[model samples]
Target: MDNGIGNWPTIHRVRHPDRIALIDAANGAELTFGQLDARTNALADALARKGIAQGDRVALVTLNSPQMLEVVLAVAKLGGVAVPINCRLQAPEVQYILGDCGARIVFSSPQTAPVVAAAVEGTDVSEIIEIPSGEQRAAGEASQSPYETLIAAGSTERVEADVAADDLAMLMYTSGTTGFPKGAMLTHANHHWNAINNLTAVEGIGPLDISLAAAPLFHIGALGIFSLPLLYVGGTTVVLEAFTPDAWLDAVATHRVSVAFAVPAMWAAIDATPAMGTTDLSSLRYGLCGGAPCPVVLIESLTRRGIRFAEGFGLTETAPIACVLDIEDTVRFAGSVGKPALHVDMMVADPQGEEVSRGEIGELLVRGPNVFIGYWNKPDATAEALRGGWFYTGDLATCDDDGYYRIVDRKKDMIVSGGENVYASEVEQVMHRHPAVGEVAVIGIPDEKWGESVTAVVAVKPGADVAEAELITWTREQIAHFKSPRAVYFVDALPRTATGKILKRDLRKRWSADGSAVQR
Candidate 1:
């Protein structure tokens, strides 16, 4: 019943104080609700003293950790926007985001310093808070103590912010498949309602459940689906810096992770790990799979292992939780993404924005409180995306007679990274810039894990020879690291039709045949 720009910190503090809140499953560091709330308050005060006020955007460049969660909560408490930057992005790409979002403060690990430094070189960012690398002597000493220590040493004057339900809460950048990255403006209400709906839809996952945050915290799947919902119900979240088959299994077994969510790529890797077969996975009771299609084989494998796997579908614009398949639907619908959330309205639409009938593949359009406000500062694009009170998701999906939906393919060339969208055209443009490149097309190839890996096919100019490594290095310099092609192949001529259009479907078929091209 609570509305009006839900107070995130209040939600945690008032419900359960002594309950375990978050754990760095990698290092075994744990914090209760009261302790986590206190840490976030200190961070909020620090950001306020540094002049980050209401509506200002703050960039978080750390990996999965409790500190990452602290800054996100602090930003929300102060009515500022939290911009979760992809840590995999290189310097120039990171710079583009810093400038694009006009963030005032950036928190990054040593691994991201060079990239953060390059991005903030000409910007107005006042502070660059470093997360201890445990490698650099000076940085290590500086970050040795807890972040709460630094906050307590500073003044504690509370900075009150005037936040409205419509104000932006988070700015999630879409992977630039076609062009420059666009930051989707998700409101606090969008996230709050999405979490409530997801918690209800998932069944039996409430206040006492423990969830895994193994995916990149920068992704909505990790942040929204798992982390936010756990925080909402005053449950526990276990953070893992990165996923390894052994590490993920260890975390699940040791931590007793009851509700776990992972992208298909993570599942495939864990499934393939020899150690996975021997691990005790009985503690895992619920599994949520998204970021790409959940293969029937993977679902069956998890089910056989005593884990219930359900399919989910969403985009950054919907606060990323639009539809979920319940446990009953998982068996009935099988591969379907299930039904829309109770408060959400979903339907397929054509190019003209008219609703299409069942069994037809059209762009999925959603309308609800969970829908985002718009893209930051991009009025024309926002107008096009949100029309007639619906957020237009450029994803192709079909609904069966039973109201279950299944995503066929993205109408836009979007590639999901651990549950984040990466547009193909955006990366292809960067690859085409190379002097030796004559023509290029980027497509997603099937990976046993990662669901789809970014792959590029290039038609080099005659008499110009470019090695795979050279193209990889050149392209990585241009875009975010994840957006770069995982593998590159050069051909005398690209497969095309008689009219001269590149045949992407054929290209994907050829590339996925063996998966042994030059991988960057």
Candidate 2:
């Protein structure tokens, strides 16, 4: 009976029993509110039977699916922390997260089963529940149970736990700009309030509205902002396993999806699709683009088709959304991320944390009920980031006289490549492992497809010769492919300061001055 996310399905089920709540676009599968409530309850009982009690960690490693949402809700119902892993991560990266969180159970799919199996080898993960992907399990692999089997064995009786509002709900991992990824601890209240803020910002979101889940559910932006908010208001959410322009357009047309959330890169691909002009997107009232800045031309093109493309800014530490540019202001303030959400307070401050003058670029600070508590198991990082009750987002932005904010640069050495955050330090670490590399500096350069592409400027050791493509391949083998440098540039020596610190600004200038970066 607490005001947690676990109660949302029950509330909606009682209010609108037969109303459609979710639609899996991949196979035209639908789950009504009544069915959703019953299934989540059953899954909660199943998790409890598996000894997943309160405060336990339950990790999910799968693509977008109705079962993914069900698992998250089930974990919440049992007062267990839900940790959704990025499906795109390599085995080692997944292993680090699984080990760090000490997950008791991991729900994986056929696609990610091999990676999960390899990751949980020495970890604390005791159960691996595989969600069916239309593939038969190998003869020898009977240790893992199918997702459907667990649900079938569970009872529909409501299984409840003593969950408090301030209890931890989600442990979201963010790829840090420096060092390994950290899990941001988001409480039940944090996610609940975020959904409230989202409902207030986007108009006409109710049971009648149909939303498209195009963004990856593992990301806070997709789950916290897009799916959770819609589910809270009893709206229908259409889940897409993965994003493809043609598939996205087809879903919007088939489901008559009213709203959606996607990155600017996705919008560009949709616009560039050959069937875009012929597709009927009139059902879409508006869509949100974040993770990177939206091109003015892309906004104008979508506007011409009666689809308003709004933009937002936030981080995983702030439950993903802090500010949003409304649909009406899409053209008026083409580049701004717009004003803060209803219950959120934002400020532009200097390095000393004092407020900056209007129109001056400074670090963006946000404070609200939606802001997460801190990073899991990182007290020092939590203290450094959450100072004076405000989350210091290491992003440089300027606010206009009218209070619209425009992001100018990232204070952190991070690159937004195709909607994924690639930390320069993480990429540099991989490059350093290469035997032929002596010194390496990674920086983000302006790119057309991705907002910014990861480029590595390397200085090979004496008597060591390494090809650009070979170095790129080497880096990809060590980390996530998306984090690997798309282009490599060899230099005699990298520009450095007297303190022996590489000046990344100089590298960016040098790379731009001479257009000689070897493209992948």
Question: Compared with the true structure, what per-residue lDDT tens digits does model 2 show for residues 298-387?
Answer: 788788877877888778888878999998998898778899999999999999999999999788899999999998898999999999
Minimum summed lDDT over a 10-residue window in model 1 is located at 133-142
Per residue, candidate 1 scores C-alpha lDDT tens digits across 300-330 of 6667766777778887788788899887667
Every model's Cα RMSD, please?
11.0, 10.6
Clash totals in order: 5, 0
TM-score of each: 0.78, 0.80
Best by lDDT: 2
Candidate 2 local lDDT, residue 296? 66
Q: Name the top TM-score candidate.
A: 2
Clashes of 2: 0
